[model samples]
Target: MSSLQDIPVHVAAEWGNALPVLHEIRHALERLAETGEARVIDLNAMPFGPGDEDRLLGLLGQGEIEARLDALGVTQIRETAVPGVWLVDHRNADGERLVLHVEIAEVPAILRTQAEDLRDAVAALDARLATGASPFPHRPDN
Candidate 1:
């Protein structure tokens, strides 16, 4: 038997052709700066190898916010270390990743409140106020 010291270890840094995807992300950022239009890049469409996704995610780092929504399926949205960049992951009920995308914008559109929803909320608040129900009752001071 050979000693452990005799074994040779080969280490290689592999990005798996992820440079092109990085370039695309840079271009998207430029477009957002120039036109104020958000860009979405679908990672599922790219030919990413085993370690490529890890590399890309490592570069982006982590952010402060994370949100999850369950409708027809479960959707997870997270912001990257970059201020205006967000990662959106959608998984089916079976827990399979269905969509993986990077959105370049101030905020992802899916997380934004719709005008109709806001209107409904406002109406509800108005109705509640009209009832004149005091959330806190007046207490006599001793």
Candidate 2:
């Protein structure tokens, strides 16, 4: 099997954007650390040649968190091995990819809890508390 470093990290010369994107990610990471600023880079906007995307994703590798959300369709969020770097994929109901983004932040914006969701959660918790119900179902000990 080819090692990660053996994988060339650049796109075809004419589509020379992948390596620069890595540099951009690095800078964005620095900015996020120094100031609480975050960044989102749209991968679909770039002209990536064959194998370039794979190479980039390979370099980033996989981190500890992976999340899948279904609101309209499906959105997959994953953290890269590097801290504060996340990969987000948004797909339509038909499962076609609509956008791919590299988001440099503690958590990708798509994965963050929305205000509406917060309100619903709060209301549900308040109701549960008023009813004096346990969130967990009762289980008999063996």
Candidate 3:
């Protein structure tokens, strides 16, 4: 086996066309902060070549929270190191990436519970309680 130093490593000098996309991401973040309007940047729409995705991911980095939803397909939501910025990845049943989005917002809309859903949940709990089917059945005081 050859020494580790003998191996050749190739490093690209610059980010190429990805700089414009990064700038767009920054502007979207500002817009979200000021107007509370979320923006999504679709990577597929951009002219991204090899290694560009990895570079962008490095810049955003991983954040505190990550979630996955499996309904019609698989949806993954991950926050970046920068607050209010998220990466939403959606894949079909065949495991192909259907959408790769960089969303700038206080929270990604996909991860938020809708008002109607909350109301329905409250109504359900109230009905269960009225039916004497308490969710907490093993109460020490009772």
Candidate 4:
């Protein structure tokens, strides 16, 4: 398996734009499952209460997320855990831990609104910059 590195972490407030990236990653995981490279774990509907991982496992056996993955043509062992950098307990070729970043969650609405505002602000800033003008707001403190 491979590890994640050099991934840019930008402060994006655009949930709409971010959705495409999530969709693309999900599609890639589906493809990986098809090629037996990796499994597609459906964490989107994973329960968040106490003992969630165990709950998900139990429910999966009851054919919840498993049915969804199967319908999507994914065939591999699947489970959901906390979303973050999961460091594999097993060592790799270089005696290093294999880490995977699990980013699973719906984008917040506040972020989308902020991102649109930021986009408009940046466009205005650029126009001011092109006109050789300072775009900073004049405040009494300044």
RMSD of 3: 5.8
Which regions of candidate 2 are displaced past 4 Å? 1-15, 127-142
What is the TM-score (0 to 1) of candidate 1? Answer: 0.73
lDDT of 1 by residue, 36-113 (tens): 989999999988866788789888889999999896689999999987889999999987899999999988998989
TM-score of each: 0.73, 0.76, 0.75, 0.21
Q: Is candidate 2 or candidate 3 better by lDDT?
A: 2
Q: How accurate is candidate 3 locally (lDDT)?
A: 0.84
TM-score of 3: 0.75
User: Candidate 4 — what's its lDDT?
Assistant: 0.37
Estimate, for each residue in 27-140, the C-alpha lDDT of model 4 and write its tens digit: 655555466343323343433343444333443233112111131232232223322111112224554533222322232121234766787998976776777555457522
RMSD of each: 7.5, 6.5, 5.8, 20.2
| lDDT pick, better of 2 and 4 | 2
Alpha-carbon deviation at 57 in model 3, angstroms: 1.1
| Candidates arranged by lDDT, highest first | 2, 1, 3, 4
Error of 2 at 107 (Å): 1.0
**Worst 10-residue lDDT window, candidate 1:** 133-142
Q: Candidate 4: lDDT of 42? A: 38
Whole-model lDDT per candidate: 0.85, 0.87, 0.84, 0.37
Residue 114 displacement (Å), model 1:
1.6
